[model samples]
Target chain A: MIELRDVHKAFGSNRVLRGVNLTIPGGTSMVIIGGSGTGKSVALKSILGLVKPDSGTILLDGEDVAKAERDAFLARFGMLFQGGALFDSLTVWQNVAFRLLRGSLKRPIEEARAIAVEKLRRVGLKPEVADLFPAELSGGMQKRVGLARAIAAEPEIIFFDEPTTGLDPIMAGVINELIREIVTEMGATAMTITHDMSSVRAIADHVAMLHDGVIQWTGPVADMDASGDPYLDQFIHGRAEGPIEAVR
Target chain B: MIALAPLAAVGRSTLAMLGTIGSVALYAAITLGHILRPPFYIREFFSALLTIGYFSLPVVGLTTLFTGGALALQIFSGGARFNAESVVPQIVAIGIVRELGPVLTGLMVAGRVSAAIAAEIATMKVTEQLDALVTLSTNPIKYLTVPRVLAATIALPFLAAVGDIIGIMGGYLVGVTRLDFNAAVYLRNTVDFLETADVVSGLVKAAVFGFIVALMGCYHGMNSGRGAQGVGRATTNAVVSSSILILASNYLLTELFF
Candidate 1:
């Protein structure tokens, strides 16, 4: 389980996250939904220790994340970035096997490559694509490659940041399905942040609505539509006029 | 208050400059600290050695060669004005070995390697590859900055030595062919006039210049703002800062050596 308590983060005058408090139970997919620039990414990054929060505590499995051994703490989590964030200098298999090739998770090159190929196949990419660079692949293929790399180490926790943001609807559905299936099969604690309604529906067991740098509403996906919160309704139905203003 | 606005602006600019200098110094200290620790990236080090040293051979060689030939001609003409044209080989040897060789090579490498390093690193930061490296349990300073800085620092002295030799050869070529000087005598004069300390000092300066070049590149790159404009600005800053530091340090090193 991951928990954030009164997390606040600001960049200069812009307070991106203001006293955000949320929790995700073990072995479940929790999707955070919000409009652009509403601190969804910041919240996820805070949990991962990528972004440090001011005057807040993030706990992973009841251990304070900021105080944990960095490598050991990070070794348990895998993340797929919003832009894929694949190393352009490396081939696809090298990117996937990056964790396996170095640090405490070191493995033999042949074994690592074999595992990378397997993960690629698991993510719907052909083994032949292993030698190709990220620039050679399509955006959807790159996303799949990113997914493959994320799960290569078989981490206990996984983060997906705007996983389906730039994909075509069909491809986005495919990725959404893959993520849902992978999270179930791995039984890993999954935390995803996306604004896509379909992705939220397909991948989320629990939904958290972040607005105004806080969680406006959070509950099981089944209870999301009838949560009786105007902000939640306005967000889910994509309404322009409501208690939540569309313009900044 | 309005009349004093210019003075306040100058004060702000000075403070900002000092802040940037402090940040860069702190960054260098951290990088040096990491260099003494474990988990060295040997593969990356060798890759940087190849990029910073071996591939830079042609450019360094060409620049020194042309500068050497030009220096010989100028020195010969200047000597003729005092009826001392025989001093060409001696002056050329000392000038190339003691100053021109390393300074020119350093400036050239600063323009080439520093800009390349800044642009590549800034692009990686923009793309979140640096963050990705962190997520993968790899330190970007160890994997990226240390290797490049170490390679440049170690490789540049050898490059300056090579540049010195090539530069002397250029003078020799010009001295024998363009001027009516005997080849054997020119070689002998150059050999007799050059001291080992002269060459060593230039090599030392090359090493320091190399450190400055890579450090500036990594610093600007890591602190780059977002987007294409940011990367471009970082590249320009890296080259400009490295060049200025190289020239400034050259004067100080010359004072220490002489």
Candidate 2:
């Protein structure tokens, strides 16, 4: 289980997170949705320790994330960054197998390559694409490769940041379905940050809406539609007019 | 009337400069600390050597050659006033070995290697590749900066030695062809006048300059701001700062050697 208690983070004077309290049980998916600049990404990053919280305790499996040994802690978690963040200099397979080829997870070259190829297959990428660099691939293909990389290590916890951004509706739907299938099949604790309503419907088991740097409402994906909170309703229906000021 | 504003601006600028220096210094210490650590990537080190040293040879050689030839001509012309034109070969040798070769090579590498390193790393940051590396449990400093620093430090002395030889040859060519000096006499004077210390000191300066070049490049690249504008500024800053540091350090190195 993962738990965040009164998490507060500020970048200079712009407070991005304010006393964010949340919990995600093991073996489930939790997707955080919010408008631009609402700090959805910051909340995810705070959990991953990419962005340090100004004041809070992030507990992963009952141990504080900040106090954990870095490599050892990171080894159990996988992350797909917003841009895919694929290494341009490395080929697709090399990027996928990066974790296995170095540090404590070191494996033989052929074995690591085989695992990378398998993960690529899992993400719907052809074996031929393995040797091609990230720059040569389309944005959607890059995202698939990033997904392949994220699951390559079979990490216990996985985080996806804006996974469905910059793709067509059809492609976005496909990615959303893939994320749901993989997260479910792996039985991993998944935390995804996205504002794509389609993505939320397709992938989220539990949903949380963030507004004004706080969790405005969090409940089962089914309850999201009937939530009485005006902020949550405005975000859910994509309305420009609501209690959450559109201009701000 | 606005004395306070100017004073505050000066204070802020000074603080910013100090912050930069402190960060660079701390980063340098961390990079050095990683030098002997395990999980060493030999491939990266070899590739860095090729990029920082082997690829840099032609530019270093050509720059020193032209400068040496020009220096010979200038020294010969200046010596003509005192009927001391025989000093061409000796002065050329000292000028190349003691200062010009290392300084020129340092500036050229700063332009080539430093800018490339900064731009590449900054682009990596812009694209979020550095963040990915962190997820993969790889320290960017170890994977990126250390290899280049090691390669440049090891490669530069050899480059300086090669540059010094080429520079002397350039002067030799100028003395024999352009001026009416005896070829054997010019060669003999250049060979005899140059001390072992002169050549060694230049090579030492080259190593230090090489370290500075790679260090500044990695520093600016790691701290670059967002977007193309940010990467461009980092690249420009890397080259400018590395060049200035090279020139400044060259003077200090020369003063010590002399």
Candidate 3:
């Protein structure tokens, strides 16, 4: 389980996260939905210690994330970034096998490569694509490669940031299905932040709507529509006007 | 109060500059500290060595060669004004070995390597690859900055030595072909007049310049703002700052050596 308590983060004068408190139960997928620039990414990053919060505590499995041994703490989590964030210099397999190739998870080169190929196949990429660089692949293929890399180490927790943001509807559906299936099969704690309603419907066990630097509504996905919160209704229905202003 | 606005602006500018200097110094100290820690990436180190050293050969060689030939001609003409044209070989040797060779090589590498490093690193940061490295249990400083800085620091002295030899050869070529000078005598004069200390000092300077170049590149790159404009600015700053630092440090090193 991951829990964030009164997390606050600010960049200069812009307070991106203001006293955000949320929790995800073990072995469940929690999808955070928000409009652009509403601190969704910051909130996710805070849990991973990628973005440090000003005056809050993030606990992973009851351990304070900030105080944990960095490598050991990070070893339990895998993240797929919004932009894929694949290393341009590395081939797809090398990117997937990056963790195994070095540090405490070190493995023999051939074994690591073989595992990378397997993970690539698991992500629905051909084994032949392993040798190609990230630039050579299409965006969807790159996202699959990113996904393959994320799960290569079989982490206990996984983060998906805007997983289906740029894909065509079909590809988006495929990725969404893949994410839901992978999370279920691995039984990993999954935290995903995306605005795609389709993705929220497909992958979310619990849905949280972030607005005004705070979670405006959070509950099981089944309760989202009838949550009786105007902000939640306005956001879910994509209304430009309501208590939440559209313009910055 | 309005009349003093210019003075306040100057004060702000000075403070900002001091802040940047402090940040860079702290960054360098941290990088040096990390250099002694474990988890050294040998493959990354060798890759950097090849990039910073071997591939830089042609550019360093060409720059020094042309400079040396030009130095010989200038020195010969200047010596002729004092009826001392025979001093060309001695002057050219000392100048190339002690100063021009390393400075020129450092400047040329600063232009080529520093800009490339900054641009590549800035792009990685923009693309979140550095963050991805962290998520993979890899320290960006350990994997990226340390290897490149170590390679440049270690490789540059050797490059300067090669530049010194090529530079002298350039002078020899110019002397034998262009100026009607005895080939054997020119070689003998250059060899006899050059001191071991001269070459050693230049190599030492090259090492320091290499450190500065790579450090500036990594620093600007890591601190770059977002987008294409940010990357372009970082690249420009890396080259400009490294060049200025190399020239400034060369003067200080010359003073210490001489």
Candidate 4:
């Protein structure tokens, strides 16, 4: 289980996260939804200790993320960045096998390459795509490569950041299904942050809505439509006006 | 009141400059600190050496060569006023060994390597590749900055040596073919008049210039703002700052050595 208790983060006078508290049970998918710059990613990154919360505790399976050993702690988590974050200089397979070929998880080159190829196939990329660079791939393919690299090490926890942001609706749907299938099969805990309503419906088992630097609503995905919170209603329905300010 | 406004503007600019300088110094110190620590990335280091040192050979060599040749021509013409054109070989040797080789090599590499490093790193930051690196259990500075900085530091002296030698050869060609100096006499004058200290000081200047170039690149790149404009600004700043620093430090190093 991952728990964020009364998390607070501020950049200068701009209070990005005032007091955010949330929790996710083991092996479940929790998607946080919010508008632009409302601190959704900040809240998620806070859990990973990537953006440190000014004051609060982020506990992953009982221990504080800040207190745990960094490399060992990080090895348990995989992240798919919004932009795909694929290393442009390296080939697709090298990017996928990066973790296996270095640091504590070092493996023989051939073994690592084989695993990378398998992961690429797992993500629906062809074996031939392995030799190509990130620039050579399309946006959707790059996202798939990023996804492959994220799960390459078969980590215990996975974080997805705006995974469907830039893709066409069709490609986004494809990615959503793949994410759902992979997360379910891996049984790894997942915490995703996206504003894609379709993605919420497709990939989330539970949902949290962030607004005004706090979780305005969070519950099982089933209850989200009828949650009756004006803020959540305004957000989920794509309405521009509610308790939340539109332009802040 | 108008006078006060101008004064306030000057104060703001001064403070901003100082702040930037302080941050760069801190960054350099952090890079130095990381370089001394363990868990070094050997592959990244060698790759940096190849890119910064080996690949830079042609640009450095060619720039120094042309400058040396031009200097020979100018010096020969100027010395002709006194009928002392025989000073060509000695002046070319000293000038190439003492100043032009290191400074020109530094400036050329600053334009090439600094911009490339900044663009590559700023692009990494823009795409969140650096953040991904962090998540992958790698320190971006240790993985990126230290190797490049170390390679530049180690590589520049060798580059400067090569540039100095090639630059002398360029002057030799010019002196023999264009200046009508006896080839044997020119070679003898160059060999007899040159001192080891002059060559060593220039190489030292090159080393310092290399450190400045790579540091400016890493510093601006890492601190770059978001988007294409941000990365573009970082690249420009890297080249500009590295060039300025190389020239300024070259003077200081020369003063100390001389």
After superposing candidate 4, which stretches have Cα over 4 Å from the reference? A246-248
Collision pairs in model 2? none
Pick out the ten consecutive residues of candidate 1 chain A with the lowest summed lDDT: A46-55
Please give the C-alpha DockQ score of model 4: 0.78
| Listed models, DockQ each | 0.82, 0.81, 0.89, 0.78
Per-residue error for B251 in candidate 4, Å, reads: 1.6
Write model 3 residue lDDT over B190-218, tens digit each, in one string.
88998889889999999998899889999
Model 3 reproduces what portion of true contacts?
Answer: 0.84
- Clash pairs for candidate 4: none
Q: Whose DockQ is greatest here?
A: 3
A1-248 in candidate 2: lDDT tens per residue?
Answer: 99999999999999989989899999999999998998998888788777889998999999999999999989998988888999887899999999999899999999999999999999999999999999999999999999999999999999999998999999898899999999999999999999899999999999988888888899999998888888888888989998988887
Quote the positional error of residue B17 for candidate 3 in Å: 1.3
Q: Following a full C-alpha superposition, what root-mean-square deviation does model 3 have from the true structure?
A: 0.9
Chain A accuracy of model 4 expressed as TM-score: 0.98
- Please give the ranking of all candidate structures by DockQ, highest first, separated by commas: 3, 1, 2, 4
- CAPRI tier of model 3: high
Candidate 2 segments exceeding 4 Å error = none
Q: For model 1, how does the per-residue alpha-carbon lDDT over A185-234 read when each residue is reduced to its tens digit?
A: 99999999999999999999999999999999999999998999999899
